[model samples]
Target: MPNIFSSLKNAYQLFKHIDFNQLDALSKKVDLPKMVETISSLDEKQLSAMMKMMGGNTKKKELPPIEGDFYHLGDEALKDADRELQLKVRAVLEKDVKPLVNRYWNKAEFPFEIIPKLAELNICGLTYQGYGCPGKSNLMEGILAMEMARIDTSVSTFFGVQSGLAMGSIYLLGSEEQKQQWLPAMQQFKIIGAFGLTEPEVGSGAAGGLGTTAKRQGNKWIINGQKKWIGNAPFAEVTIIWARDLADDEVKGFLVKKENPGFVVEKMQDKMALRIVQNGLITLTNCEVDEEDRLQNANSFKDTAKVLKMTRAGVAWQAVGCARGAYEAALKYTQTRKQFGRPIASFQLIQNHLVEMLSNLTAMQTLCFRLSQLQDQGLLTDEHASLAKVFCSMRTRDVVSRAREVMGGNGILLEYDVARFVADAEAIYSYEGTKEINTLIVGRAITGFSAFV
Candidate 1:
């Protein structure tokens, strides 16, 4: 009777430690009932010994903090106010935007609900000097772009269209009245904006081959053409359209309002990347704009290139953010995902991939940092911005690819986040400038020979 009681007590202890789900699988090869019986028959001492052999430790080991800023740029470089702003944005993004991104990304829909919340941050036109702008340094603007893209590249692209490209055109080339009318409302997010430059057939050739035409009438300009892949076009209150002038054939910019009779925007669909952004196909059929709405100083493509140069540096920082997000997500996933009874991150090969991602991310971050500094010091050139964009965008693709690889099958899943980064990296690689075009820009500067025809 005492032996029976001892066996039952030992069985209870053994069952407490045994994983029955694993035992069920083991049953496929062995007699699980018999194995349980054998375990029950063991003495208390044997049960304890068996539990110890099974690694008796039930406590989960704490993982290292998930951080992608391995070089401490935020901590070591940013001033107190700048760092606070960065963290504030990061906290808001993780709390509000992060939760809804995957759902919206899957549906290929924009979350208009967050626009008000984002406006509350008052970060638009961050680098502009007046009209309620923040008047911050270019470095700060670059960091914020990184922060936004780190959470969602779609959001960053949306903001870039608003703050960088569209607003930048007016700020750099608009009349004082134009700035006064648009900058304040845009700074407050009361009015949304979009940039229209690339037409249906002209992309890299937009510098010299803009197909959109703007003919100056008695008191207005008539614009007729199609602008494709214009971010924020579908719902933007205003769009900055670049068109070739019929008189001089030089490219000029116009502020085309949404209510214009000839302006129409159709939402682009079935995009594989940056799906949260509502890219639009804008068709302007004899769109008439008052002479006042024409950008006063944007007389030629060279003036338009000024805006592109300024925004290209921000795009480089955006690549860093996308790569950093993917690397951090992959790093966190590997630390928790178990394989062969240990974390996959414990394996040397996985660590190697993680280190490679970090190396690329760090390099991109530092490069953009210097790029922003050059802009702040009035030393930024087309070649400087182009080199950073080319190198960082190319490296971002590699980092995101490795990030997905480290996550294994989960890398492609949107719920994992790395998959979105992987797709969005392709867009970043192509937009603002393509890899080949940017490479040629840098090559031209270095060799003093323009490869572009």
Candidate 2:
């Protein structure tokens, strides 16, 4: 051991340059006593070399904020409280959802553990006026949808089928008794809901050509047919099954309980996209439904169209999220992944890809923001929603492709996140409304000609 006085002198001189705050932080990082002892054994020349290296002028420049929200809409457009909720949901996704997404996606299973916590957020039935829902504006709902999709589109779709499609069917068309019986528990997620409308035979032309038929027999309606690509069906407690009323020759929505003897749901397998979502093929053979369970005010296909109009906006928001998530992931990878001893992000070609992604992402966000505004104002027509759905889904495919291009092989891997976005975007593009169907909706509005066949 060195003399106490000499050791004290050397330690004091060595630490003199470090301010107290930094020293305190350093002490928390390392064992100070062992460091002091080890340093005391160093010769004067060695100590000088160590000190010179430690004090080398290697200042790291702060990187610019690389966010997918290239536009300031999250801050400028949302109210303070809405913005706070937006960030809170985003935090939950990044912290809780992202880590387990790949494993669940790989296994093609849903993470049921996160459901209760999500229910606790009380965001279900977001646009509804009562029955335990937050009664938040359409803008808030759209933002939350975007946030969920940004992390994982499968979860967003599951939630949408629950909150928007199933609940909206009841809220917009159900009688007071129907709403009172189901809305509260459904809003709390205690009784998860599914919306089944598309059949194996009918998809794009659902309005005019529904195969599922409901025959009213005395006090009960007998529902018979199949629903394909029904999200959350296998696990949902209640499913809103849309079928044609044989007497009226019009579509009507029915609430079918999972335990009902006539209802059978089988999980669809080998799905390439949104695999984490529990989609099922539901077959209803003589499903007995009381007249009370029918959506009382759903007299025709027009009421079902109202529910579709509302949920379609949510799908547009989801498409925006899919693009944003992939863009952010690719941008981060470029900055960290190096080629030829330098980050690929520094190259002009890579930067060009990044810029193209940002441009598309920014446009999607802004478009969805305005779409939600129109929804809130009650100015959202089928054509308006369809136009947004068309534009955003198409642009999202472009953005995710560029994001995949930037990362090369890693882009195709599930672990890199962009791959999942790429796959999920395909489902978003086709579902809710297909590209061709939505195009005609807009075309009919612009030209006053119903090009839809």
The candidate that wins on TM-score is 1
Off by over 4 Å in 2: 1-57
TM-score of 1: 0.89
- Model 2 accuracy (lDDT, Cα): 0.90
CA lDDT of each prediction against the hidden true structure: 0.92, 0.90
Indicate the residue-level lDDT of 447 in model 2.
97
lDDT of 1: 0.92
* Candidate 1: tens digits of C-alpha lDDT, residues 337-420: 999988999999999999999999999998998899999999999999999999999999999999999899988998999999
| Model 2 lDDT tens row, 127-180 | 899888888999899989989999999999999999999999999999999999
Q: Which 10 consecutive residues of model 1 have the lowest summed lDDT?
A: 9-18
Give stretches of model 1 more than 4 Å off.
Answer: 1-54, 57-59
- Please provide TM-scores, in order, for all candidate models, with all chains considered together: 0.89, 0.88
